[model samples]
Target: MPAVAPTLPDDLREDPRYYLRHFQFVLDWVAAHHDSLLAESEWKFIVGFGELPEVSQALLVRMVSRKGELFRLSRLDYAEIGDSDRALVPLVEAGMVIRDPLIGLDELFAQLRVPELRQCFAERLAAHGIAKSATRQRLLDVIQEYEEAGDAEPQRRRLSHWWTETTDQLVQLTVMPVCDRLRLMFFGNLHQTWSDFVLAELGLVRYQQVDLGELSHAFQCRGDVDLYLALHDLRGRLDEGESIEALLTEIPPPAQDNPWLAERRARLLYRLGQQAQRDGDIPLALHCYGLAGPGEARIRRLRLLERQGEYAEAHRLALEAQASPCGEAEQQGLERLLPRLARKLELPRPELPPTRQPRARVLELPADHLVICGSVELAVRDAISHSDRPAWYVENGLITGLFGLLCWEVVFAPLPGAFFHPFQHGPADLRRDDFVARRRRLFDTALARLDDGSYRDVILDHRQRCAGLANPFVHWELLEPELLSLALDCIPAMDLRCMFQRLLLDPAVNRSGLPDLVQFLPGERPSYRLIEVKAPGDRLQDNQRRWLDWLGRHHISVEVWHVEWRHD
Candidate 1:
């Protein structure tokens, strides 16, 4: 008798409709990218990798990382992604990190007793010309001891020595008002906390001994534009009820006839409109949203109209927002998002409580953390200012978000698009060399458009305009070119709720086989991929048996992954 085919693999066992060898596909994906990856470019590189097909994304992680690491990705990591849904639990449980799960900087130092980690700091300091002082060693020891046992002695010693040290006690300030260009320059990308002391004394900003969060918040509350993470506190205050209008009032708009500046003015008008909307002023909210986008503005007005049971206009604009674009994925996403919104309009809305904002709280921030944020902001800014290529800033938060932007900017200089100048295109265009430099070029352009009174897509495009959220993975930069978000032709309007269909796949393909747990992908196809997302612990839902079941039914394949298992 002819030799029977070897029993299909366990995962492929009981295959009814389809068959695909995922293991082999993963092997080829990783070998291609891992060896070529550069450390400095790691972040962008990682995000770019996501552009691969789903099977390829899943397969690449498994092939590039050890089996054990791949297993952990299935279970423990990528638990708190803010947007995209699919959970990566199984992979994490299979492979775990040896190190303690990530905690804050202080908690990390206070918890782990890895002598190797201490040695690493010692070695890094020596290499970077940061001498290992006896005081430094003492501090390290105290912190390390506290890690093993939360003895107050360690913290007390840390505090006493920190206060006595004169190392980070000086600061200096130089300001350049961004009249025409909104150019915010930090004298240096990296400043020690000591430098801040001098600035504080010079009255540039108030200094506080409290955590950086409070100090930053206080700065924002004070109405000073600080491009550092510390400004978050100020943001919170502003979010609550702080006012910075007085400070802004001092700097009058330039008399020059620049369209960009006009756009900026329009943005303020839109903001006021939002305030009115929150105040339950339906007509006013519609006006602001309209300034945001005529169609967009009308749509918002329609929401209010719909809420008041004005179905006629509400129904009309819902169709308008979903209007088809020649070839724009964003428009399509909006179009797809439209029906859900329309359905919502048909439903009754409840009376929402009045928005209550607080005054910006005042707090003293430690000098060290401020220095970190300043360094990152300055580096990226300087890089863009210095580069000949069209450069721009890409950031998430307005002021407090400067730190991360700075880090990425230092590595990626000259921001893209030579200064958000009267450009005709979006920042996703990476053909230019200064692609990374404009880490925030997207937002800057939006601001420019708003200032110019031509901000058509501002409200709907906030996510892309913000550019903050998209920078999480290294590979996303590379992935941008292939994203369905930008191209309408590449995506299909499928509710992400029931199933995730690959745009590349045609649903009408012949369905010949019976249903079994294992779905067959075209065996000859090389579409395997992997996605390694780093997120908080809650990213994966504990009740995911249903999703897994749904996923198990789909013919196209994927592996949602957690990154913890790889690096550690």
Candidate 2:
């Protein structure tokens, strides 16, 4: 009956046994909290993951702070499952607790109530913030490499130094999720060896439930947040390549001013000069090609001039390049930009779309969906709702994505972009709290896959059918048609940026066929629902009216609800 004051081993910083014991504690706690864990509120986050006196407290602090992933993903080899077949046995057992191809909505929901004694581990993902990032993947790769390596240092496992390296990787990459650092250092299985937690965290065993082909769609259509994260990660990869290039500049490859690089550099300079000339910086352009030394850069310049209505000079340069040496990538470069050159020569510049809008506001239907003829925010908010979360929180607090758990989702509609204004910046009701945290646990438990390694079929099938509306860059919202049941009878937000030459790139749907975000609620059913949202105080317009008329057709039958937000 006394309070449990947790303490950890002094040498746990180096010992795997410490982590093994720690995981046993978390698994046991969740199993016992059965009712409280199940009956948790939407806004609060409860941490009782591990057993070590220090680990349990540390997990609490970690979950409260920013570095939450370690709490969720950190686990041991499931030695507590009677440690008979340490590696493969635990996996086999976890496979039974959670299903295979674990990414789909159904499988996730199904796994919701796996009996706790059988439940090995879970991070109790918070909807308010993001999960781990690519940095985790990278660090995981590093640890995996070292662990699988042949020259196994005998002391590495018993000492904490190696754990320090992995933890350091997490910190360096800033991929520590929304948790704390000090807590991770002392408690939790993160400091332990590869176990059930690691497999689940890395999407290896957890992914066994998801067929690669099945996830192609969820991966493609998970929602705006994931897509944005993807873009940032992709760009990060590119930036890394650039960083390496910069390092090359500073160190100068041991090739030490090699002739090949010199020739390559000269050609690049020549191309820069040519580009300058086309932009009417004639002198600068010529200067660039002046010291070219018969590189590709010089040859390309003459060709550029010819395409830019400077035929006479272009002809002369072509003659100069008669004996110029050309490099590989640059040799075909002139031909690439040639079409743009020809068009300019053939006609005056094409007229750009007018910046004016036919209207200024958006439309709100009886059912909370926003019909926008002009406002960009309405479209943004709607897309976000449809894509990732079916609904976000309005009352339970920060644990919700945007609409919270009120969505009656049958489809995946991705937001136009990956990034949204942080919910923390908006309101406290949707802020991280116990209720939302509990809902996520519920959602995860309910949606867990059923098979050990059978996710391939379910996910692949769902993705093939996902008509969620995402764009050239796949964020996690549902595009129209992504849903078979959640048929949104709504209108596309106006193409405000006019990035597409034809702003109405997709054909206009007839009023009879207009999609409403709420129209498809079956028999007026989706266990939970959310109202449509629009930018604050948007005024409706004719086109929006038309779109509404289409949605109105089904508004009554769906029986959904409302809660819209506008800036004004």
Q: TM-score winner among the candidates? A: 1
lDDT of each: 0.31, 0.30
The CA-based lDDT of model 2 is what? 0.30
Best by lDDT: 1
**Candidate 2 Cα deviation (angstroms), residue 392:** 10
Candidate 1 per-residue C-alpha lDDT over 1-568 given as tens digits, one digit per residue, 9 for 90 to 100: 1122112243433332111232222122222222232233332333444444443334333323222121222232321231111322222222211111323335333422345334535544454454444354554655465445755443422211323322211111111111100111111111222233234334444311211111111111111222222222333443565434422233234224332333334444455555667767666567555555433344445556666776656666656655542122223234434565556656533232222221111222333433453543233223333222221222211111221222232222333222211111122223222333344454344334434533324322432443523232122232232222221121111212123121111111111111111111123331221111212242433113223333345422323332221221
Q: In candidate 2, how many Å is residue 138 off?
A: 34
Question: Candidate 2 residues 1-568, lDDT tens each?
Answer: 1134223233343443444444444333332322221223210122322222443333222323332222212332232232212322222232211212212222222222233201211222222132333233333344344445645542222112222222211111122331212122112212322243344333333211111121121111213222233333433443444332222223222123233234434544554565556567766666667555554555555655654567556544544443342432232333333344446456343333222222223444333233452333344335445443443322111111111111112111122111111110111112112213323443333233322322233333444442232212112243223342232212111111111111112211111122123322233333323233334444433333333333333232211223344443
How far residue 466's Cα lies from its native spot in candidate 2, in Å, is: 15
